[model samples]
Target chain A: MSWVVENLDLIGRLTVEHLRQSALPIVLGLLLSIPAGWFAFRFRLTRGVVLTAVGLLYTIPSLALFALLPPLLGISFLSEVNLIVALTIYAVAIMTRFVADALSSVEPSVRQAADAVGYGTWRRFWQVDLPLAGPVVLAGLRVTAVSTISLCTVGILIGIDNLGYLFTNGYQRQIIPEILAGVVAVVVIALLVDWLLVLAGRALMPWTRKGA
Target chain B: MDLFADAIAWIFSPEAQSGSLPLSEAIWTHLAFTFVSVLIAAAVAVPAGWLVGHTGRGREAAVALSGAARAVPSFGLVLLLVLVFGVTHKVGASTTAFVLLAIPPILAGAYSGVEAVERRVVDGARAVGMTSRQVLGKVEIPLGLPLLIGGLRSATLQVVATVTLAGYVGSWGLGFYIVQGIQIRDFAQILGAALVIVVLAVVLDLLFALLERAVVPHGVAARRSAD
Candidate 1:
């Protein structure tokens, strides 16, 4: 308990850093997956190839990806960018499939109705397809957010710092409370972010509130 | 490019193949850890999942538990368990963590696989005088095999990746190279070991994909392709 109290400032700083690291990759992944997923969905020819390739990206272990990225990207071994880039890749790998599935889940009849009402391709997608797919996409985003936050901790092993520092430091010092603090902080952050995402989903998609 | 070449060269170098723990030994240890943890996880999870799915009870609990499981960082879990179990019992500690890490996916796969079977199909089996035991064994298990394999695939991949972290707690595996390399700043060793882990994961993933395909019921496969 004293360990946590004395180290509150350090914990707070690492928590913020962790959140910063997670937020970028998640937003980038969400942005990138939209187009990548749309391409796979819109082009039947590319669906198999794109999804397979993205799935392959996920097969690479997180540690391996962290180690390999430096050499592949010509970056410094300890560069924070490597972590961010790797996390983004993973986020994209996960969310693209969800986005693709979500887009496909939109009712064809609803799409036809939008088209019959003279909605152009661009407007129709914005006003119809994206809105309908929002729930699933948001669900995907929640998964990505939680996983990315968890994954960001792995960055500490490669010299990039975050809440993971506590795990390593606590282990070396055999400070059980410190280790517990790290675990609790991480789960709390994940659940908190997940809850916020759910609230945001509710706010943005009022029609989805019917069941609840 | 030169660094990658060096890593490739390092992987093939005599030093990598002839140490207290050779690359080959590390690979084997890594595989052993993955197999044992996954095997144990399946043993516990499959039965529980079957019960939940068959009885149509505790599904919400299962889903919530898996969701919570997914959020717990494997690295932290490994370290914490090592502390709880003591350093001398690192093997047990890490194995327990891996098993816990694996159960969620396998459980989800097992239960969901059975749950996914058409309700009418199960009813027909019952109507035809099949016992509950017979329905589960002959019907749900066979039909859910593909999804069960899928869950096992994810669980195996997760355990394999996590087994690397076991090295941080002084356990031997392919991750030893990565952890040691990082401490010593040996980029070549780190990259080489990482490549081996990647290859292992990819190979395992492909093998599981094949298993999933082979296990898909003929009717299910036909329906899928027809869709």
Candidate 2:
């Protein structure tokens, strides 16, 4: 449409900023989740409580979280910072569940073999558990990445400028062309990011290519 | 109960009936806005999804489209709509945006449901001389029913939560409480709004669970056991 062609560069810039803000929560969530996941598996009693808490975290509505942030932190991008924190809470909550599920899926024999070789708990985890669980963790990462991207769109509600701004503006004005442009740009970007993650997953764990 | 008392107190407070406090008119309007839009979305999304699933062409493309739909973000969509529609009414913008929010899950569910059915079952039905339409209606649909319901459940919860974003455009929902709460630093109102959302989610989820149980074909569970 004419709207898309006219605003191509503007759309491009909004998409990039959107990606940048979204990346923070995803990267942080993944980093925090991996360790917490490992810790959860190591500590049985705590695992249930942690996973339940994380599950609850996933249910918090995005707009409510955004509004709650401004009072606690003065009205600014710091509110955006809280939004990121809230997203990480949701991501990590879901990630931990996936991580635990993946870990559980590892072959019992392989774990036993690691123990038989006198590998310390940490060493065995790195040598065996992590590699075996890599595919599932990667799948979880993919979900978290996409979910974070989606949630970050809600960031616009709090005055953060992102790709969502374009679409929201277009929709508000009833300019179908601009709204279509925004939708196209977002869909293209999301697919690209998702495919890149899948590629990374395949490259990191070639064994996953074998059908389960 | 204390909770009831608090709710009544919150409802009766000068703040509740005053300016910008969304009361019955607002609640009914929001419910209509949300339920109607979601119904519209389902009407469009469900059959299209079934067709996509049945056809099985462009599976990856369809999935990608759903993901993109999910990523579009409601608030920004409404703001954009306000400019184009030439109307400042928040309800119109919110409804348009919520439709976008509601469609993807249902589409994904229906598509995946159709794909997930066992190939041999399709073949078996055909062997019995069932017409293609009959096979799809009797065999494939029943089998895929559970996943379709799952998708609806997820979609419904998503719409319920995202509908609040319409508040930014001036439509009143529980989100009204959240927005007003923040404007006046009313923590109880904020908490009440949150509690309402959580309760809605749980109740809706439970309702979907019952719907799924009621609707999933008996043969599908039997198939699972046989497998």
lDDT of 1 by residue, A142-186 (tens): 999999998899988888889999999999999988888998899
Give the Cα lDDT of each candidate: 0.93, 0.73
**Residue lDDT tens for model 2, B75-155:** 555656655565655556667777777888888888888889888978899999999788778887777888888888777
Runs in model 1 deviating more than 4 A are: none
Off by over 4 Å in 2: A1-20, A35-55, A67-78, A104-122, A159-192, A206-212, B1-14, B17-25, B88-90, B183-188, B213-216, B219-227
lDDT of 2 at A146: 75
Q: What TM-score does chain B of candidate 2 reach?
A: 0.85
TM-score of each: 0.97, 0.78
True contacts kept of each: 0.76, 0.41
lDDT of 2 by residue, A1-212 (tens): 88788888888898889888888888888888888787677678878777756755565577666644544455442256766777877789878888888888889999999899898988988889999999889888887887777667776655677877765676556677876676566656766787899999888888889877
CAPRI verdict on model 2?
A: acceptable
Clashing pairs in 1: none
